[model samples]
Target: MSDETMRWAPAVPAANHPGGALRRWASGWWSVVHLVLHPLALALHVTALVLLVTGTALVPVLGIGFLLLVPARLLVAAGAHLERYRLAAVLGVHVPASGPCPVTGAWWRQLVLDPRPWRRAGHLALVSTFGVIGAGVVLALAGTGLAALAAPAVSAGLGHAGEYSWPFGIPGTLHAPALLVAAAGVLLLALTPPVARAFTAVEVLTARALLGPGRGEREAVLRRRVETLTETRSRTVDSVEAERRRIERDLHDGPQQRLVSLAMQLGMAKRALDRGGPDAAREFLDAASSSASAAISDMRHVARGIHPPVLTDRGLDAAVSALAAASPVPVDVEVLLPAGGRPSPTAEAIAYFCVSEALTNTAKHARASRAVVQLWHEAAPGAGLLRLRVSDDGVGGAAPAGGSVADGGSGLRGLGDRLAAVDGWLHLDSPPGGPTVLEAAVPWTVGGDR
Candidate 1:
């Protein structure tokens, strides 16, 4: 069998050697243990169900019994929790936990009205009731098989050769009948593992059906996700709009004014030249040239804010290195990304800006001497991720909700909004005293490899 299949499959047929047979049995031993423990689980489930039924019947007549529904529901939920753990530990079947029971108002209003508790009760009923049958058959078969296997030896050990015992009418000696019983015992032993595993699988399926989240809970989760996406998308749009307005404002204030001055200065220089005053025209030209250079520098700064030319030319590592070099505070930079391919352009931009903003925050607000910027790409649980970490040894206690000028919460909040644009995320961990760390990550794909 493939390794994946073998991981969950029951024991294979016994091998040639005793050791090999024992090893095979070891694989499915959990199944047998699970079956053996059914009585105890069945007791818990049955008690919960009894309370549920009794509470339901009594609540219609007297309100006093309505209180019993709370404990009943709690018991069933607890049993379901245990079932989840057991299934995961033994069968490796992970069932997602259902949402909690709604208890906003009266206990009867929530507990009796909600269908979730009923579903859990139904699962408990199915397992506890039908499970008894399977449990009985398995236990009986196992007990019978063990007795039959030992009958010949035990009978002979009694030192009676031909006297047949009354129990099951077996001959009390090592004869053909004894041999037949041993053969039957061997057949039942061979059948137990698969039988136990099959029962366990059925119980697991039932638990998943009723104990796991129901459709209402699933719809609630989807609704929550939609709400989150809506909020993030709105924030992303706002962030983009705010950025565009900032760029426009900066251009109007800086480069545009310089260029207007340049135009005025060149015009004066032309007028000076036309007046035949070479020295006056030469000074005007020099002032115009300086204005033009300043305008170019301002434009470059705005362009870097938009998307740095360095980031476009070099990869994320080199781009972040430039940021580190420019930061007022000393920054230790390290980038460990793939050489063959890189994250998508959007991801790289996010990383670059993340580093830039973090460094900016460190320099402006952190009041620290040193900081560190590290970026890397690695495989995550479900996909690949490009992660960035920026840490500073600064006075900590950064606020999460933004709008705190003292702690740079506003900038970090903007960082979060920016990351949410690409379904990325940012986490700021800054306690009191010192050492604040900002960790952010964005999912990436290998197809973007360089």
Candidate 2:
């Protein structure tokens, strides 16, 4: 799909919304609220660290060392999680969760070896110290401004002759301009939000540096991503092989066998003709013709299952409709693709496959008499997205969430693997004793290689 179609899709960056500037400006001061707990959080973290060290030092003395070590470890882990959550809650900055240690052994051993939580625990030192400074600065700017702004009103209430009162009844040697002080107050007040925002930005950067993945962790993440991609690719290839084998089996059992019989009949017809048995030849020819036509029709059916010409020419609406038409159970199809909004071939094929597989699963396991299929194109981040949905009313819970084919449900695990190959995703909802719904979404950019 072309980029023009992207305007019709779901979700955009939240920063693009109207009143974004005002929202951003207001959000700057939110971190100041987080500073309220900084000192207490710092104290708890310190206590945990001190106990952890003490436990480690006592390890050689006896196994009694674990008494302090276990609680300390729990405290550190819980504190890190809470800290990360606070950043997200106060400033909308999310720190990625740390992965568990790969080493095998006791849980405490894993905790002791894993450095991520410790790194986060160390960040509390900065959060407490720098956070205190930030709080002081904010209070000075905002408090000073508000107190100064209120000065003029307070001064008007005080008696002043040679001893002139300053803003709040304070005796002043020199009587400064009331207007000037109020103007300074307005200036400081104006700076408060931006200054708060700057500190928030710094704190966010610090948190990300300490609490987010480090260099080794990033390399591990990249390695895992590669492994996942390789796994998905293998699954996709396996699925393709399975489908190919199914097609070959069907052809061998159906059209191929029919063609073989038709060939024998033609030979018999020729033998009858050569022997001057005209009546026998006619009967053989008629049988051969019938077999030929049946074989041709079977071939067409197999070809349609592979890749239909109608799909290539007419898009998903007509193609999926054809699938619904051929089903044993009635299927409701709703496809609302615009005339010019044809998705990329990749998207169409994946969508077609999803719809086909979902329907098959529903028919085989759902025990339902009816099903529904819906397909549409929507705008996405980089390109258009094709959305496929299949729902059936039958004995549900055939495939509970996360249930795989091994669980005697739909083979959606394979579908998920296939979708992942294209940066796409699949979702299935099959609750026991009722309706089953399957949803898949494929983006046109990477999926289509656009």
lDDT of 2 by residue, 17-97 (tens): 788877766766676577655766777777777777787777767666778888887887777787889887787677886
Residue 258 Cα positional deviation in candidate 2, in Å, after optimal superposition: 18
Candidate 1 structure quality by residue, lDDT tens digits, 1-450: 554464456555568755886665665657777667667788789889999899888887767667788799889889878777877777667788888775568755786788788988887787786667677777888888998899778877887577536376643445776878899998887777778777877888888889888877899999988988898889778877888888999999999999999999999999999897888799999999999999999999999999998887777888999999999999999888876556777888888888888888788878999999989887664448999899999997675432232345555667688777566788777777768888888877423422
TM for candidate 2 is 0.62
Least well predicted 10-residue stretch by lDDT in candidate 1: 399-408
**Whole-model alpha-carbon lDDT for candidate 1:** 0.80
Candidate 1: lDDT of 17?
Answer: 57
Query: Candidate 2 has which clashing residue pairs, if any?
Result: 9-379, 396-431, 396-432, 396-434, 397-431, 397-432
The residue ranges of model 1 lying beyond 4 angstroms of the native Cα positions read 1-95, 103-212, 277-280, 336-339, 377-384, 400-409, 445-450
lDDT of 2 at 433: 80
